[model samples]
Target: MELGLVGRTNAGKTALFNLITGSTAEVAPYPFTTREALRGRAEVPDPRIDAIADIQDIPRRVRAQVQVVDIPGLAAGAGQGEGLGGKALGELRQMDALIHVVRSFANNEVAHPEDAINPLGDAEAIDIELLLADREQIERRLEKVRKSAKSGDATAKGEQGLLELLVTEIDQGNPLRIVGDAEALALGIGMGLLTAKPVLYVINSDDPGEPLPELVAYATSRDAHVSQLAVGTELELAQLSPEDAAELAQEMELGDVRGADAMVRAAYELLDLVTFFTGSGPPEARAWPIQRGLSADKAAGKIHSDMERGFIRAEVVAWDALVAAGSFSKARESAQVRMEGKDYIVQEGDVMQIRFAV
Candidate 1:
């Protein structure tokens, strides 16, 4: 899965991106610090991987990773092709979801483009830009579809009707997400509408304990998730050793859990993904993330095309059950493992061993 980080200038997007991906991306106090989009992968932390690896004595353990992209700060009029707006918004269209980094921290050194600290207003500004961009994209598509509809194309006529309704909705200051028709929403997503993608609002605040009711309500209204992070503090903690960071975090009254981890997990939930494991023993144990209702063969395809092609059946067991049994053979002997056909819907925490023929 891929997540794109977007928000107004100097919202600490690069700082959060660096902390999550362990990248050395330059973070400055000024706007447009990130000139272009930077891509990196973040390992999704799961205790089950460690449990399975320890129990199986696996030599190499690979955790599931989510792709993250840090796009440059979105200035006002970006949808109108303002500075870096065209390129940045274009980059966001390719992401699986969006992480809107809203600035709530009052830093004297860091400059807010608007010269004021209003989280709700800042979020609304960026959101409007996205809406504008989506509106323009839809209009351009509607032009072509209208031409086809005039030629008596039934599918084009239907699509034209949907686009017209959506255009009206966008004009009324509503996102495409509010549209109830599954077909219309699917069409919007297929067209890469910016507002159609899932979004998580990450509030970059110094006093994360203090709740911003306005922003929270806004997110709730939009059907999006909200997470607060002390980006500056987290970046400082990131510079320290794990032990030292843990001590500092405890001292600061923050729990040992990293904010980035919590946020990434939240992003995973936003995408409605489930994780499955792939190692019983040997050189490697790995975790894979897939959509919630992915079937056995499709999950196999996530691992390897060859596995999906030759898929016969999957030997599956819960991660905890496998750990309790200590080995795959032991789990099988105890009847904790089950044979699932290709159409079997894989479950979360499922440890699957694809039994296939070349």
Candidate 2:
């Protein structure tokens, strides 16, 4: 899954990116410090994979990984080519989900672009910018589609109708995500509209100990999730060793190292993704990501096309069952191991071994 860290200038976007991905991208208290999208991988924690590996006496080498992209901050006229606005907004469109970092922190040395610290207002402004960008994209596409429809193209005519519907929805202050699934998918892929992707608002505050009610309500009203984090503190924590970071966190009574994990997990949820495991022996046990309800065959395809081509039944056992039985053979004997067909829906925490015939 790919997640984009986005917000306005001086919203602690880069700092949050550094905290989550351990990236050293240049961070400043100003706009456009990050001109290009910074890419990094974050290891997702899955204790179930570890448990399965231990039961099978396998060395655990791999954990699940999520790709994170930190795009440059967007501005008021981002879609129309403002300071890094067009480029950043374009990059943001490709992300599977967005982590919108709203500044709730106050520091005189580093000024907000709007010259005040109101996370709710910042979120609303960002949402409006995204909405406007989508509106423009839809309007332009509708014109092209209309032209194509005039040529008697059935597909273009159909898509044009959908775009028109979408435009009406957007104009009514509704995002494309709330549109019909067919129209949503059509618009989502064709337009790459930023608001089409799921978004979680991250409230960045100076005071690590308190929750911001305004930020929470703003996100809630939009049906989005909100997470509170002190970006500066998280950046400081990111620089320390895990042990030292834990010590510092305990000392500060910050309670949980600033929600980096929660942020990633929420991103996963927003994308409707889940993790499944392959391999049972040490270091060989690895977790792979799949959208919810993905079939066994599709999961195999994620591993390799050849695996899908060979397409045999999968030996499936729940993680907890494997741990209880202590081994694959024991699990089989206990009837905990079941052979699943290619079409079987892969579940989270499922340990699968594919059998294929060449």
- lDDT values of the candidates? 0.90, 0.80
Worst 10 residues of 1 by lDDT: 206-215
Q: Where is model 2 poorest over a 10-residue stretch in terms of lDDT?
A: 181-190
lDDT of 1 by residue, 301-339 (tens): 999999999999999999999999999899999999999
Best TM-score among the predictions, by candidate number: 1
| Number of clashing pairs per prediction, in order | 0, 6
TM value for model 1: 0.93
Residue ranges of candidate 2 with Cα displaced over 4 Å: 54-57, 150-155, 209-211, 256-258, 304-306
Could you tell me every candidate's TM-score relative to the true structure?
Answer: 0.93, 0.90
Candidate 2 colliding pairs: 58-281, 58-282, 59-282, 59-283, 60-283, 61-283
Per residue, candidate 2 scores C-alpha lDDT tens digits across 126-244 of: 88888888888888888888998999999999888787787787788776766666755566656678777788888888676545776676676566788877789878887899999
